[model samples]
Target: MKFEEIDLSPDIMSGLADVNYTELTELQEEVLPAILEGKDALIKAEPGSDKIASFVIPALEMIDDREEQEGASVLVLTPNPDESQQIDELVWAMGYHAQIESASVDMDSDAEEQEEALKSNVQVISGNPGPLADITKKLRYVFRDVKLVVIDAADEMVKLGLQPKLKAILRRVLNDHQTVIYTEEMNEEVKELTKLYFEDAEIIGLEDSSHMLTEPPKVDGMLSHGYIYVPNRMKITTLMAHIEETPTDNCVIFTASKRGTDRLYRTLRKQNLKATSLHGKLSDEKRAQRFANFTNGDVQYLLVADIPAAEIDLQRVTQVINYDVPSNPDEYRYRADLVGSGKASRVVSLVSKQDRSDINELESSLKQAPKELELPEKVKQKLKERKKKKKNKKKSKNKKRHNNGRNKRKKKKKKDELELPRPSFDKLSGGRKGQAKKDQKSGVIGLIKELFS
Candidate 1:
């Protein structure tokens, strides 16, 4: 379907033309018409699909139709600051010709600036749910006139534990407002959201499949999957060797934990590799900047952890290196699918002994095992050194623990020897010193009086 056939406003059409957004994707073709008619919808589509445009274009059309509203006509709640900011930029580009005022209230940005933007005659507001919910609590009027409510990346938002804030924002909005949800897959949380918000809505792309399990993720046929078996201790060294030997231009290295991501990033930087790290600990600005660097080809490598694949739009990613095996089949698929750009790409995993079962599960889902790749000699040498180092460290730790135990025992014995018997209060008070007769029952008071005297 083409944008020209739709009844969008001239301004929105012009903006679409400016961005060359003419043809619609399959998801867009199926959902856009219903959305344009203000029907609530639940849509599940993968990343890099034109999912954002499917909703954004209709939202802009809706706001343009209701241009005279007093406050924001559309409210978009996203999972994180980066995703919110990305949508905000898209809104700016698509809404420019129409002169529709829009603001993004990313969670970690300056509060005063967000408040000031909210104070404007903004027709659209895109934001992270937590901050946006807080803002609406203080500034109740910001979303009073909202006609459209969009939860972008709903699955990820739910995963990030933003459902409470999303519900909070929904409660404040007018009950009659249209609600639309977008996600990479249908899950329990997304279902809960749909049940709570929509009476009966159009559910796209999952009619026959199980609502609980996500469709197996898939990449282009050109992408290849491979793995290198190494122990946990040598994973980093193996990763360094692989990057140095592999002629990859744009690559993303995925780690299962933030600590691993930071550790690898530090190692890469120390080796003077053009690399950056993306994880939850970074501030929004820094995360956005680093991601921009990678996307713009300013950096050749990116180390990422704990970030949902749906949250990021991986454009032209030549290679995806799994520094650690993915925890599940869905994860394996998502990471594999990130390798794209019409050219042949690669998904490489470093599987340790503990990760063998995970690899088997991924193979069961993918119906093919990853081709085993030989580790470089340098990585093998590093493996031996790591084993020896770990052994030495363990010996040192045991020796130190043994010495500490002996020292504690000696100190305890000395403390026991130096101890003296505690005297009873009666004996210390001279109760039986023979100062008073046995029949005299004056007790402690009599002893005190006698001592004073």
Candidate 2:
């Protein structure tokens, strides 16, 4: 269904049309109406599924009706600073005046200035619970007209030890305004939070099948899902070869750790490849800049950790490589779906014997085996050759060192004999001239010859 069909204000509809978002995504189609009706929603949808719009559009519609007086009409709370920035950008791109109050300790000066400038209108506040709680307290007097409070990624916030602070803020806001909670997983924490805040409110659960369609349009002529088992040492080589073969304009490589992400990024860059790294360690500004570069096609490869769970959107990504298999089945599903969502045609994973048990268990738990692909012969051969050559080179270096040490010891013995002092013949004058002198000279000559030789 088109976004225009929804019962929204003409201004909001025109704004969506201007951005060329003509059709509503499945999640948007399912939840927008219920949200517009002022009912509390507990949505479980992936990122890039138009979930943001489901709430943002309706919230904007709600605010547009009361445009005359504004003092923080809408508040969107996210788990991390990165997602907060991304959501704020989405809010702005919709032609709505908004601000992103970074919850991070090191908020960008420019972003802070912009947020301060636009604090009076509909703005998105993103930060850790500590800073947000502080802001909420201060805004109690400054933004007394705040109406809508949204907790995006509610499940994650609870997992990251932000629950208490979040609870405090919610208690303060629930005194007068409405609350909306959105998450990808409906865990116990999410349930508890929902119960505490939206006790008597409506709950709308968008079924998984309803939100994600079965068949997505193909990018090229191929659509495949598979995994391969390889040793740990060969993971980087395998990924490089895969990217070289696929010939895509852009690709994403998922690593399990921040160090791994940086390592892969450095390795790829040293090979003269265009790549960027994204993880929780980076500053919010750096993360935004890297994401922007990747989306704009300035960077061909993006090495990201699990931080892209909810905010990254790359429609033109042609391939996704899982450098390390995710341990959690749900995480595996989420990452796989992120890249495989019709936009990315190929999803390849590098698994090893060590990873097989976990991978098999995950597959069994999920009840679907990702199509398995045989390791390419050339890649296999190259890996074996690399191992053999490394071993041989180490052996040769050790052997040469041993031989050089033995030769040096022998030369040092010869040099010591040549530098030894000789006794004077005059000291032996008391003995019989010819016999004694001949005996002494013979002894000295023999000792010298043995030592020198």
Candidate 3:
């Protein structure tokens, strides 16, 4: 359906037309009506489905447009800074009359300044949930008249421990207000919240059995899936070879841990690969700056820790490389969602022998297996030998350690048995103390006689 058919305001339609957005995508067609009617909704739509516009339009339509409204009428909570920034820009595009400001108190900005933004004729407050509780607790007066609250990417916020912030905001938003939750995945916590918060909310994604399982290459705008099976010893070499051979313009390489990012980033940089590291270690400012550099093509590659699902978006990211196979389907889904900008993108996962089963499970969920990309025979043989040698070395060290421990215990036992008892000087004789005094006097008289002789 066209956007105008849905009863959106002229200003909102103008903003939509400015961006050439005329018709609603399937996701919008599904949930926008309920949202616009002020009914609580739990929406599940894939990334890049342009679902934000669906809710943004409704939020704009609900603004009353009367100059008398006060405080933040709508509050939207995202999972990370990148998503917040993306949504903020989207809000500005549509919220032409909104006194929009950030409620991202836990970020780099001054808490007071962001608070000032929240209280200054604020109609919409968009930010992460990390600091929402503090703001809500300190400024309860401002949230009393809120009309709607949106928990965008709710599952991701739960993963990042931002539910406490939501709990804080919900306590003060005034009861019986509208709530809309948008997420790709729903777990027990989300369902529990659904039961606790809403009396009769409509669910969107689970209406059919066919939608339960997502097929790869179609689920999240990913065009192809390919995997290279290599041992740990040959991973770097294989990765470098693949990158050099493939003509991808920009890549986000995911490592399993912060330490892994450090090591991989250094190796890539040493090879003059124009790579930098990103993980939980970097401050918010540095992380933002580095990501901006990568997006602007100043940095060619990002060696990142297994980034949270919502925080891994870039405008022109052509490829996503899993330096190690992801541990769960959520991570695999997150990594796959990176490529939804209408341009085709590739997701390549490096699967070792141990990771084959994990890859199989992920494939099972996607209902599609990954095409195989082979490593060199020489590298495979070297990897086999190195693994065997490493295993033997560990056994030898364990044997030596056990023998040393046994010998130490045996020596301690033998020394204890060979020890003699020491005498006590306080017990002069076996009889009594007076007998020893008389014996001492006799000994002195004998010594005097010998001297006279």
* TM-score, structure 1 vs. true: 0.46
lDDT of 2 by residue, 1-453 (tens): 977677767777767776788988777877778778777666777665377777877777777777464446676776666666666666666644322222221134254554454454444444556666665566562445567778878788788888887776666553376677788786546666776765555455643322121222222223466788775567777777766666777788888899898898888899888999898778989999999999888988889885643346555466778788877565565555555445347777789767888778766765456777777666888978888998899899899899989899889999998989886556656646755656656777867866887
Which parts of model 2 are misplaced by more than 4 Å? 96-127, 137-143, 206-453
* Candidate 1 residue pairs in backbone clash: none
List per-candidate RMSD values in Å: 19.0, 16.9, 17.7
Top-scoring candidate (lDDT):
1
The lDDT per prediction is 0.80, 0.67, 0.72
Query: Tens digit of lDDT per residue, candidate 3, span 1-453?
Result: 888787776777777777778998888898889988888888887655287777777877787454666677787777666666666677677665443333444465578877777767567777777665676667764476677888788777767777777777677777457889887887756665555567567678754322222322334533576799876557887787778767577888988899888888788889887877788778989989888888888878888884564465565478888888887665677677675454557788888778899888887877555677777555666777788998999999999999989999999889887785665655656546656655655776857865786
lDDT of 1 by residue, 63-131 (tens): 788736787888888877876777777888889999887888987789889999988868888898888
Best-to-worst TM-score order: 1, 3, 2
- Inter-residue clash pairs, candidate 3: none
Question: 1 or 2: which has the higher lDDT?
Answer: 1
- Alpha-carbon TM-score of each model against the true structure: 0.46, 0.41, 0.44
